[model samples]
Target: MKNVSADAINALKAQCRGEVLLRDDAGYEAARQIWNGMFDRLPGIIVRCVGTGDVIKAVNFGRDHELLISVKGGGHNSAGNAVCDDGLMIDLSLMRRVNVDPKKKTLRVDGGALLGDMDDESQLYGLAVSGGGIISHTGVGGLTLGGGFGWISRKHGLAIDNLISAEVVTSDGKLLTASAGENPELFWGLRGGGGNFGIVTSFVFKCVAIGPEVYSGLIVKKFEDAKEYIKFHRDYVRTLPDDMTVWMVVRHAPPLPFLPNEVHGKMVVVVPFVWLGNEAEGKAFIKPIQEATPSHGEAFGMNPWVGWQSGFDGLVGHGARNYWKSHHIKGLSDDCIDKIIAFGDTMPSPECEIFIPHMEGAPSHVPADETAFSYRETPFVLNIHTRWQNPSDDKRCIAWARDFHAATEPFAKGVYVNFLSEEGEGRVKEAYTEAVWERLVQVKQKYDPQNLFRMNQNIKP
Candidate 1:
């Protein structure tokens, strides 16, 4: 890309309603920082867009000036695609506004909105979207774009499956709306195609009926019983109904009151879940896990689903260096469970964890060709989340995750795109089938032929 002229830059600042920042600008540093601490790239320009109009100006400015471009929504992607060096960074953090229609059972969220922000607003009407990552502060744009899933996902499908429509600004600087009736192909690609098509300014989602509270929390067990517990969990989950979702975590026990002090900071298996039903039914549903293993600790109760979604926020908060390696497991073979426990026994950091999320039921019901998201047949996803402070521990934590991922590679068929880091194109291809990848490329060529939105898990035009 060619350098932007000073005169053109000044014109963009004058035209945009929001702030257009440069290197020496007061807020440039803060605007350019992303969730992943490892990336320290200094963008040449940063545009904090407050509304869709400002987004148009920024896109046009970058396009006309032939500058390298990047879009920063909530800046939570571990790959650091939200911001880049020597480029124009369009920061949408200020555009976080959510509007809910109770009559229609839908929500329209701005691109800059965080998952928690959406939840806070939507839950007021006893309506919810099947969204949010473990960290509530994650951006809605990236998460939904890459096939969102959570505790509720097993019951109601992924966020992309519930997405009804979206407003996007293409590389040509033209605003377009995508839905089933208009730009159908674009809508299909946007389901799990990442940010390659365009800058999505807003999303319209079909909400599900949910209460203020649900049965949710964790069941902790000692490391010694992990093998038997995993075996039981593997079989038990298959028998569970769609409304009950459970995932496993292997990590050192925190100083929560439920656990005995003797078990604090020791290896433990935690089974966290959300039951979308009455407390009586939930208790019965969760009883089998407790019976299967003599739990060292347990914490389960009826809680607010909206608030419970962000329960892991403090563990994976902002400014921590995070590297994640993940896979879509077909089934939990004895060998696979043993390998997971072997590496999890020696977790390198307190912040790191071995996450085994159940991805069955509702998400699998979506036909493979209906959306860009593949791997619908997958039952589980193992995320080796490596998060730690201190730049010195980066090598140690990252190596552990990679080695663990390699050990379990044979058991996985594909991968969940959202959990992937900056692995290359081969890994990206693994996230989709040949047909879906080709369809994405066609959509890319139609909307962003010049590849201006190549900062994400890119689909080449």
Candidate 2:
């Protein structure tokens, strides 16, 4: 890797509204860091961009110097695609800001803001755009562009589904606003197409009034009950209303005060549910799910959105090795349930878990052509999230994930790109159909012919 040009560094310092750190700079190590602990890249420059103009200057600098470019919004990509070796990283973390127009029922958020930041701001007004995992730390840009799905997904749709508009800087260094009525094709591509198009600077979303308080918590069952409970969860989840969302997980419980001491290291099935409506109806909707089987332990009730988001933060966070295998399923077959439970029963580490999210309701209601996101027809997404702290255990965890996926592939439809890693071009192509792939390539050619944004789950120009 070549050393960063002193002249380019000087220009960045002069023109950008952000801090520029060369590889030899004091804060270089920290600025180049990403969420996935497995990746170790050394970027020549990391620009802690303060605003959209700063992003433009950094991009232009990269282009002028023929430096490969990567955009870091939340730095949480399991693939570690947000930064690159010997490239220019436009880090947006400093640009965190949210502007809410409560009367207008809309929110304009800075590109760097995480889902948590957006949720906190909007929830204060009893408003939210569909966002990903109650985990508030997921960045809006990465999640939205990759078609975010979480508790509110079945009701409000993908994070991109609620996106009203986005301000983007293209490869040519021109900033433009893309929305339904303006630069419509680019807007369609951004919905689920990852970051192949450009650097999204700001996003305006149509927010819906939700809860300052809601029904959400975990129901833990013994690992021995995984077989029966998982089968029941698969069958019963489909019957849930759009207002309720749930994910079935298999992992050892952390030493939470609420968790019993004896069960701290025991394998367990954690079924987390969130009901987004009136308390009475929410309770009624979840009652059938709660009654599906006897639980060894259960924790459920109303809680603030922030509390809910941060509840599991201790278990999953930055600096843990993350390897993900995800597949979208049209139906959760009996065999699929058996394989998932079997894998969960032998989880290699406490951080390792299986996530199966139902994906019908609002996300599927939008026409398949409405966005670049394919597999909307799929009913469920099964993710074998192999996470651990020890590098020596990486191979074992990866082996378990691969084996688990092999056993369940017969029942799966395709993979979710957002949950993907460096599975190569064939797997990337398989994430979408030939038609969707062709159109995405065309859009990539139009907006980024040189493939300036090629660091993501790239769609070649």
**TM-scores, all models, native as reference:** 0.98, 0.97
lDDT of 2 by residue, 1-461 (tens): 36456775887799877788877789889988888999999988889999888988888888878899989999887989998998888899888899999999999999888988888888889987875556777788898898888788898888888889999999999999999999999999998899999999999989888778788887777777677777777778888888888888777876756677898888887888988877788778777766777666777788987678767776778899989888887687778777777787788888888877788899888898889888887888888889999999989998988898888889988788888888887888878878889999999999999998889998998
**Model 1 TM-score?**
0.98
The local lDDT score (0 to 100) that residue 343 gets in candidate 2 is: 82
Q: How accurate is candidate 1 locally (lDDT)?
A: 0.89
Tens digit of per-residue lDDT, candidate 1, span 1-461: 24778888888889888899988999988899999998898888998998999999898888887778898888998889889889899999999999999999999999999999889999999988985566789999999999999888888999999999999999998899999999999999999999888889999999998978888988998789899999999989988999999999999888879899998889899999889988899889999988998988788887887779788887777888999999998899999999989998879988788899898898898889989999988988988989889999989998998999999999999887888899998999999989999988899999999998888887889
Q: Candidate 2: where is the Cα deviation over 4 Å?
A: 1-4
Question: Which is the leading candidate under TM-score?
Answer: 1
> What does candidate 2 score in Cα RMSD to the true structure?
1.4
Q: Give residue 282's lDDT in candidate 1 (0 to 100).
A: 89
Task: List CA RMSD, all candidates.
Answer: 1.2, 1.4
Model 1 is weakest, by summed lDDT over 10 consecutive residues, at 1-10
